[model samples]
Target: MISLRKLAPALCLGVALQGTTAMAEEVLFYHDKGFWSEALAKVGDASEAATGVKIAESPYSSAEQYKAFVQSSIASGKAPEMFSWWGGQSLNDLVATGKIAPLDDVWKTAIDSGDFPASTADLFSVDGKPYGLPMHIGKWAVLFNKDIFAEVGVEAPATWADLEMVAEKLKAAGHTPFAATVQDGWRGFIWFQELLLRTNPDAYAKIHTGELAYDSDEIREVFQLWSELFAKGWFTDVRSNREIEDFAAGGAGMYLIGDWAIGLLESNNLPIVKMGAFVMPNVDASIPPAVIVEGSPIVFSTEAGQDEAYIKAAEYWMSADGANVWGAASGNSIGNVNAEAPNEILSSLDASINEMGASAVLRWWELVPAQLQGELVAEFNSFMLDPTMEQAEAVMANIQALNAEYWADQ
Candidate 1:
């Protein structure tokens, strides 16, 4: 059997769990808190019992923290045998390090065994080479309180005008129509991306890739509409961290969050029956409806010797059993064909994605080039905190400047 220690001499020793010895072959698995730690512990126990390979489970509190840890640890050859990550440009960084092994063979076997459909395998592929196993698919939409909408005499809006009308009614009824926050930086992109894509999906794509300027009229319109919401007092406090709680506590009429956040409400024993999710309204009636899609995946570490034990552990984690275990705990939809989303909202999202055609855009949070992600987040957050035409223009100008510099260097 190949030994990881011998393969990477500088690996951080603490990466190994407390009881693991140099001679004992154990596969370390790391992920963000989306997968409840206890559920992972159960999966690890089951994997070990069936394969006789120890699976050490480690989890970080959030995606940002997980990314930071992975970035620092990879330099020391301390990346786990397999770890969860976002696909697209986020995975590009690790792939560039020459420390992430391609999972083409694993994909082929998985498809052959009927564990995943050939089409599903494409989610984990980069440049036609599979590099990870998809763990969950999250759809971005507005999760609204049914009772609050009804109480305000407003149904879920189907068009931009309808949405504006509903927001007016909700505000008149003394309710914040939307729960919003800019403190996390990433949260600021949700509305901006949604509005831009709804306005013109193709233009949104072009703008992100630098084919269109960030300060273009189309982009500015998104800010104008978003500012209107803030101007009407239809939004919660700009930095409110209690969005989920506010939505659940009847303090906010709706929340524009990912489907994954349903797990948070469910775990907190929120009134699930009162909540319903809907794709945001199209800003232009002429444009097609679009929804943002995000994928969570697990990538194999090259430094972790790809021996029989490590391979088996990774395969088992990506298997139907493992997917089901994760779905049951995380309230996330598993990519495995045999596994289904644990809730109705996710099932509805899956069906919509199949029907939406060109309307499903890859999430901007991870789709943008890594070098410009932080800058874009900061720029967007700045506008969200102070939603004004001046602030919006300045933010877009700054983003365009950064965009030009980064692409020029590229």
Candidate 2:
């Protein structure tokens, strides 16, 4: 089992105190994005205006510190009124703590009014009870530079073969075919997940549940293809921290990332007209089309659920008006189906996804078991740096070992 005690003291001196006293007069909205303070403040203002309850925004500098503080607070029976959390296994682990309250009632209200799709409930639910609402929903796609593609005489690829052809063309034109890095450590899984989903999405879905082995032939094939790409010099230097900036400046041809990166491109002064996006084509055409979806959820504490004012504010946060306010302020795709898309790229991508009938799979980061996430990510990062057949074998071995141990105990 995951221990909450270890995280309690890590950030106690910095953030724990802030969550305590705010519960008296306001609903404390604690989250890890310090940069999102202004955006969240706007949502808080709107919530207050609608519900007559003040929503206080508390932003933490780093995810580690924020998680530590939230875990510690929940352990001490003093959990914050509201906080943002990742879905999938992370949310499942939190729900197991019994501190998070089921928001089935709130979700019902949203669904009844067509504010949120009923399917969204599955993302934040554990054992059939919903515990949170979506904060942001992003689709992972191939974000490419239109000018670079036009210059190279290549358009968006519609198949795995076409993608390779595009990469070769871009490389011959003196451009890196793709942006890739292990800079933050967690990013090693970006391509790993994408390739696996494109090649064998069924295996990708089952592997996280321990029903499929990490060292199986299907996974080995993914590594083989990845190694071939590395050998061809199709990726950016794994050590570089400027993946997005390089792609923005035309140093790279394509970047496979979530639609959320649109905001980063805009911030870097990359014109929206120059950006294009497409869902990755399947390596196995026999399989159904699929796109990865990442959903960040805002969970409420059981203690906070007792406060009528806070509950009212949370209800407002789930409404279309509240979603519009938050989406406009944050430049994010709101969970509410009725809310406007944050940008033209996202709007078009959503339409394409619907038109193609692509299956929406959860991103691997959240789908993987919480206990094995960091260790497995480290293995993948090492593999990205080496990317040899020899290293591929060792990486799969280490991942399977960690995965096996976690599932054995479960």
Best by lDDT: 2
Model 2 Cα lDDT, one tens digit per residue, 161-255: 89989999999999999988886556889989988988888899899889998999999999999999999999999999777677888879899
CA-lDDT, candidates in order: 0.76, 0.84
> How well is each residue in 35-97 modelled by candidate 1, as lDDT tens digits?
367667777777777666666777877657777898888888666667888788888777888
User: Each prediction's TM-score against the native?
Assistant: 0.87, 0.88
Clashing pairs in 1: none
- With candidate 1 superimposed using the best TM-score fit, by how many Å does residue 199's alpha carbon deviate from the native? 0.8
